[model samples]
Target: MDRAVQRTDHDAIASKLSAVKRGYYEDEYLELFCPRFEPRLPLINIGTWCRVRAIDQAITEFLEKNTEGKTQVISLGAGSDTRPFHLLPKHPNLVYYEIDFPTQVRKKAAIVRRHLSQKVELCDSATPVTLEGDINTSRYHLLGQDLRQLSLPDLDESVPTLIISECCLCYLAPESSHLVLEYFASRVAHLSIVLYEPIGLDDEFGRVMAENLMMRGLCLPTFQKFSTLDSQTSRLRELGLTHTISAKDMEQYYNDLPSAEQKRIHRLEFLDEVEEMNLLLRHYCVVFAGK
Candidate 1:
């Protein structure tokens, strides 16, 4: 299987696992992955739920306040993510754009067409070629572009934009990641960027985490390069984003979540691995930057 396909497959599996545990919103489409992988560990399910919840909250807050003009959301490396479908009904005026490698985009396009043809519009057969691939669209536009090259689709700069990179940046080399950030910062006028990535790689747990990923031939090139809140904030600042805020870890993010919401998710599973969960949460961080 293609690398992009493999990554997306893993993501689908994770989503399905989290849904099975009832840790977040249900994604019935992810059930397609059930034959390939059994239920994932409770820890994996919880981690996936936390990440999804954080990003969802950020986008919700953004959409709730900025309900003017043509609101846009650009999701980078949006492999197998169904956020657009979830957001469309709430904000029918918003235009969503998802970019990823060609293989991933093609696969996702087919899936969306099969399941949501009535809701989305796939561009005509003669889709214009820019890089090595074309884009399919509806309310959501899914484009095929190499993140390393960083060529964004034609977009209205005047519109308030929300850019998301959930667990996506760590896969790129530090320079490439910076280039991606700089591309957006230079173009989008009013923008908010929400990044979810692993950090805290200076300790034993971090080392083990890094080694485990490496052993699977997965490289987190920018993990240690921006492994703390200060480094993450500084990176955004250097890239020209004005106001930046970062959570030290998921623990902080979880603490900051609403009490009712926290109780809801905690009740989803019988979590017994308190110590391990804390250590896991401490290794991941959420950073938000805007101009």
Candidate 2:
């Protein structure tokens, strides 16, 4: 296994921290994951803002429509994600499960024990926190399990579950990614899965993006296979899996946001790389699939 892939977690957190620092969004918990973050490029911050807010939109829509009073959110390869911190307390009926590598999980445990005790209610307050790769609380569960060898622990199959695969599963082979989706599609009935990944990799801009990542020992296997929004949607409907699927590029996502929000974000920074940013946004997309 290429452990270098796990280092992407740092990028995820740092980019988000950059966005937060620039006031593109509000994420108090993200700083706790990576305390010291040098601000990233304005372009990077804008992209991060769009990527995160787009995903947040998908998750928000899922939560609003499926207000069944009992909901479960499973984040695959959830590395230092602060969604649970913002969501768990707000939505009392929601239970969040974050699955990631053992080392990453334990890293989060150290921080959670040190800072999160006052906010999250522990599952068993009497039990001491160990060095193991698992954290249990009333509203959140951080599991130390590899997605390549995924054996889920105690999932309520009947709950209206929303699975988030944000830039994680693309590291795997296309077949492996499909298997991960199939695994969940088979288990949950009222299931919705949202994905944030790079697409349109066949283009010149996309090629440059791929080369840039490759220089850092990273590979996105779904680059060519699901390179377009249609392919991304088709992959979700593969094996007769999901019923409804919506796919949109980051540019479209930004346009879809309320005009006031777009104006507010523009005020945060001077975006001199509008053309470059649009190209980068075109190469990436956000997808939603529900069954």
Name the best candidate (by lDDT). 2
The C-alpha TM-scores of every prediction are: 0.88, 0.94
Question: Between which residue pairs do clashes occur in model 1?
Answer: 121-137, 121-138
Residue-wise C-alpha lDDT for candidate 1, range 155-226, written one tens digit per residue: 778888889998888888899999898888898888889898899899999999989877777778799799
Which residue pairs come into collision in candidate 2?
Answer: 200-227
Report the error of model 1 at residue 74, Å: 0.6
CA lDDT of each prediction against the hidden true structure: 0.75, 0.83
Give the Å shift of residue 53 in candidate 2. Answer: 1.0
lDDT of 2 by residue, 67-165 (tens): 877899999989999888788778878889999989998998878877875665534466555555588765678898878778875788988998998
- Candidate 2: lDDT over CA atoms? 0.83
